[model samples]
Target: MAKRRLIKALAALLAVLAVIGIARAGGLYLNHTASYPRGLWQKSGDYDPTHAGEHPYVLACAPGKSVRREFIERGYLPWGFDCDGVEALLKRIWAVAGDRWTVTDAGIEVNGQLVPNTQPLTEDSAGRSMPVQTGGIVPVGHVLLLSDYHPRSFDGRYFGTTPIKDLISEVTPLWTESP
Candidate 1:
């Protein structure tokens, strides 16, 4: 009887361990998808929902942190990119190249010249692209990003441009070779 009870207890313990492992793996996958910086979760910073009366260049997905590796592998751009990856990429570009870009209601202006809105870039998802504009000059440290599909996205068209300083990190593929 004692041996049987011990075996049963050990089996229960193993089952619990397995459950814990699966949960941890799921969490890690979600973080990867949410585009959190590589390795270990850390607070990026407080991003004010309001652009603070300044023109923004980047659009960040709300609930930005997760661990979904499949989403990243699919080249989904940013996790919450409802349109194209325009908002996320613009934020990254602005962070790298400052003072050279501007956001406005007439579209993106580079070096005081207007950049006509490009054709809607398509992701795997199906959607139509829309144009966005603002009436303010993109400050020296900002870039304006909008979703390629404005009607379905909550991006620069809604929140304005993002500051270059608020960018957390860029997401790139971990592997290139096909499985």
Candidate 2:
């Protein structure tokens, strides 16, 4: 009986060590303040994690030109923009170059209909005034980003548009239970 108990304790210790290692290696603990959402997992075996905007996923800043103010369908890591020196974000790509876009007080309209959760915010949570973005034609090499899940998402409605040249790469969920 003593031997069995010792074995159980050793097993629990190993499990705890394994979990700690995974969290540290994956940088899960640092993700929150870092600005980038860590993907829980991939939805399926067939899904490729490297493809950009294939599905909802995380994004990491690649080494290149630092982006200025801009948000897309996917959330932007504060690091995506060099402003304020925040961390990176995760968002989706809604409209790419060649896609006609119009910005208004109500929200952003692609072609004609309004985008969900795009109603402009009068001010941020901190009560700072939010700037209104003027919409017209989407310029070449620019992509519109947004998130329908969150109405106040700091996306195209706020930042205007993202330059394609600034994109790093699309990240697939590390693991996902749902399809």
TM match of model 2 to true structure: 0.56
Best by TM-score: 2
Instruction: Compute the lDDT for candidate 1.
Output: 0.39
TM-score, each model?
Answer: 0.31, 0.56
Give Cα distance to truth, residue 148, candidate 2, Å.
1.1
Model 2 has an lDDT value of 0.54
Q: Model 1: what TM-score?
A: 0.31
Candidate 1 — which residues are off by over 4 angstroms? 1-107, 112-131, 146-154, 175-179
CA shift of 70, model 2, Å = 12
Best by lDDT: 2
